[model samples]
Target: MIAIDNKLISDSVLEAQFVCDLNKCKGGCCEDGDAGAPLEIEELNELISNYEVIKPYLTPEGIKAIEKQGKYIYDTEFGWVTPTVNSGICAYGIRDEKGIIKCGIEQAYYDGKLKWKKPISCHLFPIRIQKSQQDEDLEYVNYEPRQDLCKAACKLGKQLKVPVYIFLKEAIIRKYGEEFYEALAASAEVVKK
Candidate 1:
């Protein structure tokens, strides 16, 4: 583990290669999970604040689900999460013509409609950040690739020689600060020796 402040980042995040091959996976992570994408408290507020801006990018079903379930829902195990469409795909997920699911919030951001992209949890997918139960100040940054869904991404990452941390650079920088990311990179360099 690479310890920086209160967070312990997994070695797998440094050693393993992983990049999302969206074409191959078709955004399976967005649709196949037991629950919708986890949302931070700020993200829940963003959804509520910008639902109107994001609505046009969503599918009919997704919009309907959001309308019925509110902007987000509380999950016992996961805390706040985006509401799912009929308990299947996420309400914020928009399926393109090619059937690849995409985050409507992200799409809206791409179109310059909103400043907030998507849930940070969704942004840092495969790398989950959970607060340690034993210590309030501690959080674990774990690289948890789902074999059933992430085969193509894993294989492609190996082929491309991209380390998981590098693959998730933007996300890591988003969650942690740039200095923390530099710390992680420095740790990776030391570990490589």
Candidate 2:
């Protein structure tokens, strides 16, 4: 594990390769999960505040789900998460012309309707963070590779020689900071050697 600040990053984050292949997976990560996308407390507030702007981009079913379930829900197992439609796709998800699920919140951000992108958890995908059991104030960041949804990404990452850390640079920097990411990048180079 590479320790920086309060985060303990798994070595797999440096060794594993990944790059999302949306064509192959068809954004299955958004649809196949048990619950909606995970959300931070602030993100939940953002959804509530920006619902009017985000509504136009949602599907009828997604809109209904969000209306009925509110912006976020608490799962016994997962803590707080965005609401899901029919217990499948996230209520904040919309289907593209290609029939692939996409995040409505992200689309709104791209359209300049909102300042924040999608939830930090969704942005830092395949790298889930959890508070350390031993130290509540500390967090652990790990590369979690699910073969069914991410096989193509793994193959592509290997082909492109992109490690998980490098592939997720933007999200990492967004979640942590430039100095934290720099430390991670430096550690990745050492691990590579």
Clashing pairs in model 1?
Answer: none
lDDT of 1 by residue, 1-193 (tens): 8899999999999999998999999998998878889988778779878999999999999989988998999899888988999888999898888999999999999999999978988889899999999998999999999888999999999999999999989989998989999999999999999
The C-alpha RMSD in Å for every predicted model, in order, reads 0.7, 0.9
Model 1 lDDT, residue 176, Cα: 93
lDDT of 2 by residue, 1-193 (tens): 9899899999999999899999888888898877888888888789888999999989999999988998899998888899999999998888888888899999999999998899998899899999977888899998886768999999999999899998889999999999999999999889889
TM-score of predicted structure 2:
0.97
Model 1 TM-score, 2 decimals: 0.98
Where is model 2 poorest over a 10-residue stretch in terms of lDDT?
33-42
The reply for model 2, stretches above 4 Å from the true place, is: none
Best by lDDT: 1
